[model samples]
Target: MQKQTGFASILLILLIGLALTTLVIGMVTSVRSLQDSSLTTHAQTQAQIKSAIGYQALTGLLKPLTATQIAQINNGVIKDNGSPAATIATYKVVTTTEGCPASTGGKNYFCYDITAKSGGASSVVRAIYTDITTGGGSFNGSIFAGGLQIGHTRNLQGDQTIQVGAAPGGENGVVKGNGSSTFYDDQAQFTLATGITVQEYTPTKFMTAEELRASANYIFYANGKCAKNNLYGASIYNTETEPVTCSSISGITVSGSGASKKWTIDAASSAIPVGVLWFEGEVDINLNSSRDLVNTIIATGDMKVITTNQSGAGKAYAPYHYYLEASTNAATKKTRICGSSSTGIPTQYCDTAGTLKALDTELAKIANILFLSNKNITFDVKSNSPMSLYGNIIGSGGAGGTGASSGKFTGNGTIDIKGNLSFTGEGLTVTNGTVNVKLNRGDSSGNVTPSKKVMTLSGLRYM
Candidate 1:
């Protein structure tokens, strides 16, 4: 009986020991699982922190740089903090000469690949920027102006684009005057081209007067002479204060034809070393012959162009007859003021080899013909005669009035332009005539191009 009792006690003791061992093993497993979860959470938090740091570094690095400076940057790595940090994220910059996928053909742009890396993970960012002033010396559009107004029976036609507003904060528009005037694109009356965009009333500033003068090829006084003095006063035509007559000026040689003549300022002629010409007083360009201008003309005061004879009989004369002749070579080096009375000037007239060559050479060096005036741009037109002009026109004091006292771009006859126009002070008004424009892409091929020295941020991408 004693032996049986001993065996039962032994079995009970063994069972208790086994149960305690199982409980200890379960506790160990639970602790192990908890430790693993905690470690994973800590690692994830570190990674997130590192990523944030890397992004911050990239943003700070790119903020203040100009487009040129950004393009010049070399491939390299930058740390989040100073060199000897305990933990550091990194940003890598890589530049490519080619454009991004969405960039236009022939655009001057640079693409940057930026990679941010930390804690075994990375993010890639891309940016594309354009050179705004790439074609600084040239203009591709037909007409650019500050304020524009057209009257009844008038047509503003062209195959090129038209731009308005030389700089920000200036007034600009294509006035809705009874909706009688018409605009034509690419010889199709009342039509616009596929890719042609009219930037009407955009608030963007262009080059300043001082900036343009600094880029001048030649400086002259009134009456085609060199500048020799310095003076300043309120304009007789406007309220704006400007340099007095002949105080600061550029030079040009005026010759060829009747009272209406050609103004020449060839840099190769040794008289003017540069093709840009600046005049301190009024600039009077009389369109008398088929001539070529290879220089930009800037005037401080008013700029005026008028036909020598106002009577209908003058249209039958030599230069005036050629001016009205449909057969006259529009492509040659000539000043075509107005379209032919019978048929409007064909687009082919302005596409001559000689005219292109002369204009191209000038544009390659200085870009476009920049005609700047402090007061107004006056066009005196006769009845039944059309006036045509080629170049960029800027009136700083707005449009002069029809009266002898008002400073405005006022006219009583039809008008045409193959360039850009801008007015700072007032607006442009054309009464009883049409204003036509045939945009010029300031390049050797006469293709539409962008301005030089202007830059804008195009797009950003992330990978």
Candidate 2:
């Protein structure tokens, strides 16, 4: 009996000790788990704070930068010091959206997707930006000419001044470049030469076929009949000249046939018929021989301009044709006209307008442009001097506005102005002094040119 009682007590004591030990272990584990959760939460909070700080810092950093400064940033020049947490920040421009300009030096807009790290975690956001020049110092664009031979100037097109909200130039039109491209009196402007970077340009990045079709507000027909189109609502033409099965347009005149078609649009025309215009067939532009004029056209066909003789083609394409007062008072250079007497714009503004311009003097300062879209664009431009064109000239991948076909230069050609002028899937030949683009818009491109740029997070989604 004594042994049994002793054994029972010892067993009970052993069981109690085991229970206590198990309970203590359980409590310790629970406490440890809570602490672990708290630590994880704290770490996440720190990461979030760091990410937010980086985001805010980058956003502020890009703002207030000059157009040249922006270019430096894009080219990895790293001019400014980034935020402390973002010392390891790196970014690539994921997307760039280009918009038509009101003038040569207006804002060139673009958007980008960035992936950044602030040491703890990674975050992604979209940024929209725009770069604008005053005028007459740049032919802006990042061009990839297969056989580059330029002598004059070229400027890459600029992009939208996109903000957290809102939508997106011409004469008095300033062309915008995305900071990666430029033009010069390098191409023989054929005096037509611009840009040196050997980058293959994918036209779809600027405009896609579907996007092109969707962008048009009106359509014109072969029967000389026109109709209001897709996004033509709220148009000045809608109220003034509502054309449905209409006979003709007032301000626009068309002449010639095939690659020699001559199309003219004058602001002097009773009204500017369409906002964003598109044409099905190739276009011919009959430039004035005796006068310097300004015209705007956006087409999905071949853009044709009347070419002039070699001497005439060698003449500069002056942006100050209408503002003759400035052109004459400009640098000591002669006017774009084929003349020994006419004076061009002063070197202060026009000379710098050339793409890659370094503010030199003695070179004729005026520049012009020719734009081609993906759908089908033919610029049959015939002019006395180098032709200054506006709009896209050639598009590849059938992604944007127009197409390019084989043609002969019945006349000499010099191109002034700025914008996208990419060619592809064809024989590539270029020369120097033939094309020139100066994109200094501050004073020469447009005297009253206005500049505004905005950027912000388009969306914030966590991964």
Candidate 3:
């Protein structure tokens, strides 16, 4: 009986020992599971934080960057960078013609499918990007001239003071208004802002003539390269859907040869022509357009802005030179170059910013139409001509195309301008009309206020 009792006790002890061992094993397994859960939670939080960082980084890096460059970064064409390998963000880019709600057509918006990691955890976010150009470069003054000639004030409020630069021969230049109003080389009567350089006024400073020549939706070679007016090749911006003139006469009318070649261009009545109107020879440009999409003109020769018919024509004329913005001489046509007519800050025309625009007018002129010339310019109109030029003009040499008259303005008209002028020409020869130049620094690109873009997007926020 005693032996049986001893055996039962031993059996009970063995059972208890087995139970304790199982409980300990179960508890250890539970603890390990909890530890893993905590580790995963930490990793996931880190990944989310990293993803947010990438989202915000886009604001600074979006502009001055093109979709091509972004793709390069995504396709590993660009080197990956990060302190720790796991901390870097990885992304894929997907472009769509109709992706964002604002995108009516075209690749208007881009999205980033981003993946960021921490330990074994990964996070993803999809971000759409758009920009607005509220601020960028600004106009230095109403008029910038290599020389100034003023007989009398035509417009009461127009730019009273003209910015002057030295002509080629170290001539102090001349302003004919305040003093004798003479065209001969004389002292400047206005405050000489000589610190303002003439190099800044060159349209080529913004883009070269060759670069513009390549981007033109339509081109005329006074050099007689191709047929005058309406280029024959496929347009870069798909803008050559129609011609400017309805009659047999092409848009460009040429009369002379060499530097004196006279090129006159008519306006597009059917559709607002897109891309640059690049002319190889000097021209009398008629500038005015409703749509702000593509309206810029560039000339290799001299420029003359025809404000009205030399005969008494009642209608207003813009210019024969470059049309950087949608600003028209006729106030009735106020569609800005980068925005709608007096709408909120320009959004639709806000652009994909990049240095690649010298050849891409589709995006280059979306902000400002660098309406400039490498040669001299003439704002041609009678003093009483019912006209007003609401845009800015810049050019190179004098009334002479870098020749004997290169150092002076011998053009037969008043130096009257409604906007600003910056040139390296000798001076104006305003012998007949009143100086109507009022410092009317109107909003750039035709907007009531400047709307540059593609501007900073108000919707760009961290998710």
Q: What is the TM-score of each predicted model, taking all chains together? A: 0.42, 0.38, 0.44
Query: Given candidate 1, what's the lDDT at residue 114?
Result: 57
* Total clashes in model 2, counting residue pairs 3 or more apart in sequence or in different chains: 157
Tens digits of per-residue lDDT for model 1 on 119-156?
A: 44555666555654433343455333443443432334
Candidate 3 least-lDDT 10 residues: 350-359
How far residue 257's Cα lies from its native spot in candidate 3, in Å, is 5.5
Instruction: Give the per-residue lDDT digits (tens) of candidate 3, residues 168-256.
Output: 34345543344352433422322332211222223212334554454444556655544223232333133323433322335556787
Model 2, span 1-463: residue lDDT tens: 6656688789999999999999999999999999988876776665555445555655677777665565555512112265542243344444333321222344554444445443344665445555543322333443322222222233221221100100010111011122123432122231222223323233222333223332333444444555554221233232212466433556566666554544554333323332334444444444544433332234545454554443343221223332332245333223222212212112222222321232232122222222333333333333345655433233432221122232112233444533334444232223222233332222233221112244433345443
Residue 360 Cα positional deviation in candidate 3, in Å, after optimal superposition: 13
- Summing lDDT over every window of 10 consecutive residues in candidate 2, give the lowest-scoring window: 162-171
Where does candidate 2 stray beyond 4 Å? Answer: 1-11, 18-22, 37-42, 45-249, 253-281, 287-293, 306-321, 324-407, 411-425, 428-463
C-alpha local distance difference test of each model: 0.43, 0.37, 0.45
Query: Quick one: ranking by TM-score, best first?
Result: 3, 1, 2
> Higher-TM-score candidate among 1 and 3?
3
- Candidate 2, TM-score vs. the true structure? 0.38
Report the lDDT of model 2 for residue 342: 19
